[model samples]
Target: MIVADGIIELDNKNKAQGSGTAGSVLVLLSTYDSRVNDNNAIHLKNDGNSGVIYAGNGKIEVGNGNQIKEATGWKIKLKENTTVTYGQGMAGLFFTGPGGSYSLVKGTYQAK
Candidate 1:
């Protein structure tokens, strides 16, 4: 769900498993119209790698030692060895937004 100028509240957490697992949450907030806040967010998939980043032009603020992790989306199966994915992939999470904004990107990206 995409939201603007709204608040997000999550009290508990559940183990996620599926595509687009590792990702992030973008917080676009600007203060005094001078301090612009533009952060790309993306959720990692179950089979995706770590330290992936997207492209966006804006200021991104994050807490100390806070990083994005792989969080997939799946359904509960009653049968044995059953697979049910919500058909969500990296494009669903780290999709190309206004500027290719995404999450699940590693903090310390190596010089490349």
Candidate 2:
């Protein structure tokens, strides 16, 4: 869980697998405010075989050149403006709940 304001970047040229209910490689459980164009990028990638990444939880406000690359099946509950770019043959899934507001910039958005 990310509980601070920072950047998360993941560029993989290999295979990485994650198993579980969420299959999440990164989970944001707090606020990642980049409203002022801090250039903070949240890049989560799993380009390898069976490499699935997920973005779960929190209020992630990524703007001002902040980029995000999320691959695999996820259960996301975003509370801010964010962009998620996924790999080929993969999609981004957003979970619905109370206080869950996700404004996706791009990617395959699946409702779960």
Candidate 3:
């Protein structure tokens, strides 16, 4: 999982490869915009693997020759020649229940 508070800019020829038996899952979480500039900018996949990119409150722009499994954002722009294969069993992984809540872990925080 790649989490960013701001923009995530991926240059040309960048790869976020994954490996495993359950296949691989690459999760890109950003609070701001994520961009892939130029052709061949990113390759977010491994054979038969599942990859997911999520931009919480921002947009995602991908360049040509890029490959991915799935992507979700406020706005998504894809250049020519980009490839995306939506894999199976991916729906359950990103499900958010209604009224979900979070609580802080006890004793994990330290005062500065």
Candidate 4:
């Protein structure tokens, strides 16, 4: 997991790569903007699955030719030709704050 208070910039020169076994999730959480501006700049993979990127209070800009699993932010901008594959296994994954617990909502349980 990567938590940044400010901007998180990723380019060809500075990339974010992930490699590990299954269920090894990578989380990039940024309070500010997160920019990925290059081909193959960020390759986040866990076995055959991908990772997550979240910008809590800012925007997320993804350039072309990069592979990302899922991304969420206040605003998201994707340049032409970016690849995003959603992992079904991630649907059961949830993040919680300190001392938080899981709760049932609409017949489904999730972290709160």
Between candidates 3 and 4, which one is better according to TM-score?
Answer: 3
Write the candidate numbers in order of decreasing TM-score.
3, 4, 2, 1
Give lDDT for model 1: 0.28
TM-score of candidate 3 to 2 decimals: 0.65
In angstroms, how far off is 73's CA in candidate 2?
16
Runs in model 4 lying further than 4 Å from the true structure: 33-50, 95-112
Q: List the residue pairs that clash in candidate 3.
A: none
**For model 3, how does the per-residue alpha-carbon lDDT over 11-47 read when each residue is reduced to its tens digit?**
6666664555566777777766334432221223223
On residues 1-112, what C-alpha lDDT tens digit does candidate 2 reach at each position? 4434455554543333344345344343323444445443344343432332332332222332223454322223222333455543233333334555556456665332
Off by over 4 Å in 2: 1-4, 14-17, 20-30, 49-112
lDDT of 1 at 13: 32
Give per-residue CA lDDT, model 4, range 1-112, as digits (tens).
7777766656543445455675566777776533443222222322222357777556777766666777877667776666788765655545434554566677665334
Candidate 2 global lDDT: 0.37
Better of 3 and 4 by lDDT: 3
Best by lDDT: 3
For candidate 3, the per-residue lDDT at 50 reads 33
TM-scores of the models, in the given order? Answer: 0.22, 0.30, 0.65, 0.62
Instruction: Kindly give the stretch of ten consecutive residues in candidate 4 with the minimal lDDT sum.
Output: 38-47
